[model samples]
Target: MTDRAALQHRLEQGIATLGLQLPAGAVPRLLDYLDLLVRWNAAYNLTAVRDPAEMVTRHLLDSLAILPYVTGSTLADLGTGPGLPGIVLAIAAPGRAITLVDSNGKKVRFLREAIRSLKLEGVQAVQSRVEDVQGQFDCITARAFATLADMLGWGGHLLAPGGCWLAMKGRRPDDELEALPPGFALASMHSLAVPGLEGERHLAVIRHAGAAAAPAAC
Candidate 1:
């Protein structure tokens, strides 16, 4: 059985560490999502991380680490397995139209159930390869999805003008940065310090090369 009290305490602490201002009732809803993930993971193997306690930091806190950098009115999380930051973001931030995209049928099934169970009004789950997904978004996020070049190559067209693509990676991908498909440029890169997470994590912010340059994110 999962330790609900311990997980809640830990999640609360992690949110505090991230300095996030989540909407009311967001915490309980996050735990609900986590529970759903845990139950579904038991049979489907949706995520590699198995332990519910470990998931508090690895899955939940790790995703919340990027909350500060998320901007714009609409967001899409490509390759969102079991809703990672997508469901987490929809719960915490609220109001933004969020789409969780993944090519795997089982994963997308989990996402649709998550949205329905969580009562996430504006969130959606799309089953498609990133390249085939339609419509532009003000913000795009791809976590552990693909190399910078490949992600941009497949989904770069979905980034609306003046929008940003937040690519989550481990080490700074210097080589991949150079290979970004012709029009995208690195606006900023922020090193993320996720509570209780080991190793380095980086979020690369990219925009159209023609857009006015913005200062590096801290």
Candidate 2:
């Protein structure tokens, strides 16, 4: 099989392992997105994950692992370098308004092209630092972007009332969670298992301190 075809097989297996029900045509488009990233990374150095097969496990599957936790109509992916979970989420579950934010011009440029090429409606790419970007969103996602305090401190204002913030991390961020600025509280925490990924993965669900409480995830 060709390299891309092999990558497709790996992704299929990973999704199956995750027991996800993706919208139709998502898998193909995801592969197409991977193809785009491979081409662009040659020049822009988008991601350190240089291998396509590994990206299927590390990037695609890792992003999809958070799909179950992502809720709401509008989402802002802060510091979304080359649209990690942002683009991946947009492709997997259609119809959500997704804003892919990045300070790097090259990354945002690639994101715009991906949004256009993939025909992803309601998805926009913004080239700006997290602190300067404006607009509230129902769901916020940051993948290994920064410490919880820094991320919440910079982009916390963008989180709408009753909305949730999803922080993807390598392991349980005990120290960072404790250091979360006032007005933000942990809603729930989930351990994520990505097929073929060796290291630990965790998702921190946080909500505004004043928001109404809800039942925690099972």
Top of the candidates by lDDT:
2
lDDT of 2 by residue, 1-218 (tens): 98777888999999999999898889999999999999999999999998999889999999999998888899999999999999999999989899999999999999999999999999999999999999899999999789999999999999999898999999899999899999999998899999999989999999999789743431
TM-score of model number 2: 0.97
TM-score of each: 0.96, 0.97
Model 2: residue 57 alpha-carbon error in angstroms: 0.6
lDDT of 1 by residue, 106-135 (tens): 999999988988899899999999999999
lDDT of model 1 at position 150 = 93
Candidate 1: where is the Cα deviation over 4 Å?
213-218
lDDT of 2: 0.93
